[model samples]
Target: MLKIYKTKLDEEKKLLEDELGTLGQVDKKGDWEATPDDKMVTQEVQDEGDMADRSEDYEERSIKLNFLELRLADINRALEKMNGGNYGICEVCKKKIEMDRLEVNPAARTCKEHMDKVV
Candidate 1:
């Protein structure tokens, strides 16, 4: 069961990274930043306006990238816990997390009872 969850989490992480890379680039500190490609630039005033429009698009992408990055971090943390023999244990209650809950979100840090306390 843990192996299945890990596999799914790993797949999701890769997809998120791929999606993020398409709309942005990873910075030196491992943060994703949305940026327009050079091809968006052209030799015309209207092209300059297009650049501005692209900037707005990049901003939206940045917001989405940030969300996905946070999820990826959570997934990675769960994977790390599995390696340390702590998989499926709720952080708040230290109880075995429900399999159903784990199925829904393998990265969850708390059981259903402490769901509100999850960081």
Candidate 2:
């Protein structure tokens, strides 16, 4: 069971990192930052419309990158827990998390009963 979850998490981590790579890059601080469009950056902004378009695109990518980063963080945390020999334990109750819930969300931090509190 643990192996299955770890494999799933490893696959998901790769996929998420690949998806994130398309929209942004890791900065010096090891955090993801949205990259501006190459064309927009190289060419001069001729009008307000062009500027707005670039801004909108950057904002959209930034928002998406932020969401992907959060998911990646959770996956990383879960993997760390797995390595620490406490992968399926609930953070809130200090009990073994339900297998069904772990199946649904391998990175779940709390049991079904205490899920809301963490959320």
Q: Which segments of model 1 are wrong by more than 4 Å? A: 39-49
Q: Residue by residue across 1-119, what tens digits does model 2's lDDT show?
A: 79999999999999999999999999999999999888776656767788898999999999999999999999999999999999988898899999999999998888999999874
Candidate 2: list runs displaced more than 4 Å. none
Best candidate (score: TM-score): 2
For model 1, the local distance difference test gives: 0.85
lDDT of 1 at 60: 86
Q: What would the per-residue lDDT of candidate 1 be over residues 74-119, giving only the tens digit for each residue?
A: 9999989989999889998899889899999989888999999976
RMSD of each: 2.0, 1.1
Error of 2 at 52 (Å): 0.3
Candidate 2 yields a Cα-based lDDT of 0.92
Task: Give Cα-based local distance difference scores for all models.
Answer: 0.85, 0.92
Angstrom error at residue 9, model 1: 1.0
Would you estimate the TM-scores of all the predictions? Answer: 0.86, 0.94
